[model samples]
Each structure stands twice: as structure tokens, then as C-alpha cells.
Target: MIRHHPDKNLLLEYASGSLPKGASLVVSAHIQMCAECRAQYRTMNTLGGSILESCAPQAVNDKAFHRLMGRIDQAAEPEQQVTPERSKSTEPMLADAPPVVHKLLEKNPPIKWKTIAPALKMCRLKTGQDQYEVSFHRLSCGGKVAEHDHRGYELTLVLYGSFSDSDGVYSPGDFLLREPGDVHRPTVTEDQECLCFSAVQAPVAITGVSGWLLNRLIPFRPG
Candidate 1:
């Protein structure tokens, strides 16, 4: 069962199209997986539509009709854009993916997982900008992540298996938001491997004396 979710404020921002692109993507994926969030999103959209309809209408500029016609003409003869070729890796199956994520995977190459630590493998994805770094973290049974605190906001979505932190245990389809002040270490459950998608706005600051000393040498920051 899903035990966690993004807060109402973030969902409202997503519905109003005000969320940053990286954060928006994470919310969109969660909406697809959680029926409760999907219902909330639909309700928010409805309310927004009602508010817009109640607003006073403004008079169009004199050149509006000409501009509309020009746009129509351009649409009639659309330009053919070129896209990069796909690599040799097999294409990702749609399966349970949301439309946005599925389309993105179709355009890009398959994920190439890399080992970052013993029992931990990571597959990073481009967020199309430097403001956020997104990655899929895979942890083997009984694996543990170093204790750390976020420098900015961090969003984590559990995609497979389960993990536990100081707050509680998390299962698939769960959403967690960690702020700059929160600090915790995550450890995978023994039943199976845990896979999670994480998006961060800033690097992480390692906690504890040992981690702090290692951070100076290895820069244990997040993307």
C-alpha cells in the first residue's frame, strides 16, 4: 500500500503549472501511480477552470486576428525536425510507465547502471537542465545509504521493493520530500532489492564525524 504522498501545496503548484520542470516530472509520475493523487489533480484542474471562467474577459488587440491567421498558416506547413538516433540497447517497455516517462525513454537510450558503492548501483537521467539532478538508485538487500541532509529540497519516489529510514518504512508508489534540515539514512529491506527515483535541487551534506571527514576528500554531495 502507498503510505506517503506529496503535500497539497506542491500538487496545487503542479496543477497551476508553476512547479519547476524537474519537480513537476516527479509529481506527474506519482499521480500516475496513486489513485488518490490522480483524483486530487483532477479536482484542482476543475477548480482552476472554474476560476478562469469567472474572470472578466478582456478585449482582443486589433492585430490579434492577423496573428491568429499567421499561426494557422505556419501550422499548415510544419517544419520537419530531426532527432538523434537510438543506441543499440533494447527499447524500454511501456508496462506501467506514465505517458510522459514512456515518451522520454522512447527518445533516449536505455539506462546504463553504474556502481557507486558496494551493493549500490545508480542510473542517472538528464533533467534537461542543471537546476536538478535525477537518478534511479538501486540497493541490494540489506544495503544502506550514508546519513546525510539535503542542502535544498529532495524528492524521492519508491518504484520497487522497500526501504526504511528514521521516520518510517516505505513501499512502492510512496512519495517522500526531504527538506534541508532533515537528516536520515536509508536501508533496504531484506526481502528484495530496492529501487527509487530521486530528484534533488542541491547537493547533500554528509552528517556524522566520519561522513564529514570523508566528504572533504570525496565530495559526497548529490547531483
Candidate 2:
């Protein structure tokens, strides 16, 4: 189950084709695995269409409506089958996955290196100046991350294994969001390594001894 979701406002921006390609890719993937979100997306799309029609003085073109209906029908066709045996054959199956999943897993924007701690390493995917940043963090088993607070929105999506904090346990595929001012210390599971993709709006404020050490050895600032 999805532990966190993009708010209705974000979904509306996506359905209206206003979101950037990279951000839209992530949102689309979340909607595919979440039925509630999918329903909400449909409702938003309908509402947006109604608003446009209400504001426009000219009548809608019959040919344009027919073309749009055809495209929708094509998108609704049944997905192709994939055998379990075939799925395991590929190292990366993102290409063969659904459109939304494929887009999310696409190799683009490139990740740049950033050291978090001795036991942790991060790579940031640059979006733009003063905008959001996505990062891939690799944590060694039993490693403890420095306690930190977010200045803006922070979304963490677990891609492998699990971790825990004061609030609760987060496992693979779990989506967690920490709004501005939220702080927590995350500890990786002793039995396995933890890998997460995090999206942040601002630099994290590290605290305590661990933070001091990390700050001296590596740049802990946001990308």
C-alpha cells in the first residue's frame, strides 16, 4: 500500500499537463499502483474539462472530440501479458513495464555524487535552480543517519529493504513525506541495506555529533 501520496493539487497540475516531465513521471507511477489516486485523477480531469467548456464561447469541434475519444480508447486497451520467467530474465525490466512505470525509471537527468556520511552516499538528480531535487541514498545496514529537519517538503520513497524512525517503519515501495519543520533520525535495518529515492525542496538541517562529523568530512547541503 502507498504510505504517502501526491496531494490533489499536484494531481490536478499533472492532469492539466502543467507539471514538468520528470515530476509527472513519478506522479504517474504512483497513480498506477494506487486506485484511490487514479480515481481522484479522473475526477480532476473531468472537472478541468467542464471548467474549460463553461468558459469557452465557441462550440467544441466534432472532429477534435472524436480524435480525443479514439485516443482514450486506445489507452484503455488491455496490457500485454508478461510471464514470471521472462520477467526474471532481464536485469532492468523498466522498458517492458507500463508507460508510467517506464517513464519513472528512465535514465535521464543524471545523478551527481554527494557524500552524506561515512556509511552513506547520495547522488542527486538536478531539476533546476531554486526548484526541487531528487536523490538516491545508499545506507549500510545498521547505519544511523544524522537527525535532520526539512526546510521545505521532503518525499522519501523506499526502493529496497527498510528503515525506521520515531514515527514508524518504512518498507520497500513505501512513500513517506516530511513537510517543512519535521525532523527524525532514520536507522537502517540490521539485516539488510536500505536504498531510497528522496525529493527535497531545501537543504536539511543536521544536528548533533554525527552531523558535526559528517559536515566536516562531506558536504551535507542539498543539491
Candidate 3:
């Protein structure tokens, strides 16, 4: 069972198509995995449709109408590929991973893991969005990350295995959001490795002597 969920305001933004690209992607992934969230999203979408239907229709100027028609004509043309890209190697998809994860991998292509600390590897993603830096984090069982504070807002969705921090344990499909200055050290359970998808508005503001020393070496992000 999923314990955490995206806040109602976040879901509302997603329903209204106003969420930032990276956030929208994570929300889409969560909705696919969480039945409760999926039903909520559908209800929100239905409400939006009803509201739209009740609104008074407005006259479209000739130029605007022509532009809209042009877009429709373009959308009607079907010549591009419909299949999602796959890895050249036979990389099996995770059994419980949402479709959005696969779509994201297709868009980014090639998964390369970078070791930032013992038992922890990160794969940064180029999501074509300037507002957030997205990535995947994998932590082997018994692994722990140095405690750190958020430089800005961050969202994490667990895809596999369980991890624990100051607050509570997070199992698969748990949604976590941290605001600036929130600090916590994450540790994976001993039973299995943990895999998570993360989106951050800024680089982490790490604390402690060990983290600072590590910062000097890799600095986490490329300059």
C-alpha cells in the first residue's frame, strides 16, 4: 500500500495542465502506480471537463480560428513512429514501474550510473525542462547517504524496495516532497536495494565534514 501522495494542490495543477514538466512527469508516474491517485486524477479531469462544458462559448477571430485549424490539420497527419524506443541490449523493464518511467528513459536514452558514494549510484536525466534537474537514485541494501538539507524543493518517488529517514519508512510507490532547508539522511533497508526517481529545483545543500569533503571532489553536479 502507498502511504504518501502528492498534495491536493499539486494534483490540481496537474489536472489543470499547469504543472512544470518534471513535476508532471513524476505525478503521471505516481498516478499510474497508485489506484487512489489514479481515481482522484480521473475525478479532477471529469470536473474540469464539466466546467469547460458549462462555460459560455466565445467567438474565435479569423486568424485565431485559422491557426487552430492548422494545428488540427498537423495533428491529423500520422507518419511518425508510434513505438517507444528500447535499449539496444535486452534490458527488461521493471515489473511494477509505471509507463512514464519507460517513456522518460526512451526520451533520455542510455542509462549510465555514477557512483557518488558507497553503495549509491545516480543517473541524471535530461528532461528538456529548465526548472528542475531530474535523476534516478539506486541504493544497495544497507546503504546510507550523508544527512543533507535541500537547497530548494525536491520530490522523490520510490520505484523499488524500501528506505527510511527521520520521518518514516517509505515503500514502493511512496511520494516524498521536501521543502528548502528540510534535512534528512536516507538509508535503505537490508532486505533489498532501493530505486527512486527524483526531481530537484536546486543542488543539495549538504552538511557535515564528510559531505563537504565529497563536495570538493565531485561537487555532485557538473560545472
Candidate 4:
């Protein structure tokens, strides 16, 4: 069962399209797997639609419309463009993979995995902006990541298997958020490997001697 979830305010931000793209992507992935959150998102969207309908509509100026149409007409002139064909490999490997996850991978071809540690491997994803860095992490069972904290904010969504930290155990579809001051070590106790999608607003900061040493070799963005 899914134990972790995004708070109401985060969901509200996602529903209103106010959350940053990197954060929104993780929330969307969670919504695809969590029925409770999906229902909440629907309710929020319905409320938003109702509020929008209740607002008075603004009249468009005729001159502005004509100018917009003129620009559109000019752009409509034929221009040769090439479109690449999407490959079948773009499909998600997991049967229950979230739509947003699939969509993301479909646009940005998957990257080759590289080992950062003994049991940890990761690859980057397209964030479209420098505001946040997004990536996929896979940790083998019995692997324990160094205890660390974030510089700004971090969102992690478990996509497969399970892992545990100071707070609790996170299974597939679980959503975990850590702020600048929060610190924890994630350990994979289950026999299966853990796969997660993570986004960080700033770089992660190592606390201990071992972490500090590893910090130099691993480039975790700093706030």
C-alpha cells in the first residue's frame, strides 16, 4: 500500500498549474499511481473550472484580433519541416508506468546508466530549464546511499521496489519531499532493486566525513 503522499497545498499548486515543471512532473507521476491523489486532483480541477466559469469574460478588441489573425496568416505560409518517427522502444518497460513518466521518456530518449557507487546508478532527464535538475536513480537491494540533506528542496517518487529512510518506508508510488534542512539516508532493505524519479531545486549537501569525501567525486548541485 502507498503510505506517502503529496500535501494538499502541493496538489493545489499542481491543479492550478502553479508548481514548477520539475516538481509538477513528479506529482503527475504520483497521481497516475495513487487513486486517492487522482481523485483529489480531479476535484481540484473541477473546482478550478467552476471558478473560471463564474468569472466574467473579458471582451477582445477587434483591432487586436485582426492583428493576431494577420500574424497567423503570415505564419501559415508553407515551410518545409522534418518530424522524427517515435520508436516502439519509447514505451515504458513497466506495465503500470505513469503517463507523465512515459511522456517524459518519449520526448527525451533514455540515457545510458552510469554507476555513481557500488549499487547506485543514475541518468539525467530533460528539465527544459536550469531551475531544477531531474534524474532517475536505481539502487540495488542492500545498497545504502550516504546520509545527506538538501540545499533547497527535493522531491522523490518511488517507481519500483521499496526503500526506507529516517521517516518511513516508501513503496512504489510513494511520494517523499525533503526541504533544505531535512536530512536522511535512504536504504534499500528489500531484495528487489529500487527505482525512483527525483527532482532537486538545488544541489544536495553531504554532512558527514564519508559524505563530504563522496561529495567531491559526485557532483550534487548546491543551493
Query: Judged by lDDT, which candidate is best?
Result: 3
Query: Among these predicted structures, which one has the highest TM-score?
Result: 3
Q: Give the least accurate 10-residue stretch of model 1, judged by summed lDDT.
A: 74-83
Q: Write the per-residue lDDT of candidate 1 for residues 16-75, one digit (tens) a residue.
A: 766776776677777877888887887887898799899998877869968756544422
* Per-model C-alpha RMSD: 7.4, 6.3, 5.4, 7.8
For model 2, the stretches where C-alpha displacement exceeds 4 angstroms are 9-26, 57-115, 127-130, 210-213, 216-223
Judge candidate 4 at residue 170 and give its lDDT.
Answer: 94
Each candidate's clash count: 0, 0, 0, 2
lDDT by residue for model 4 (1-223), tens = 8889999999898777667777777887888778888778878877987998999988789998897575444222211121133334432423455666666677776556779888799877875757777888889898998777888888999987889987889999899999989989899976888889888888787778777677777775411
Candidate 2 structure lDDT: 0.63
Clashes by residue pair, model 2: none
List the candidate 4 regions with Cα displacement exceeding 4 Å. Answer: 59-95, 220-223
TM-score of each: 0.78, 0.66, 0.82, 0.81
Give the range where candidate 2 is weakest over 10 consecutive residues by summed lDDT: 78-87
Better of 1 and 3 by lDDT: 3
The true-versus-predicted C-alpha distance at residue 211 of model 2, in Å, is 2.6
Candidate 3, RMSD to the unseen true structure: 5.4
lDDT of 1: 0.71
lDDT of each: 0.71, 0.63, 0.76, 0.76
- Of 2 and 3, the candidate ahead on TM-score is 3
TM-score of 4: 0.81
- Pick the winner on TM-score between candidates 1 and 4: 4
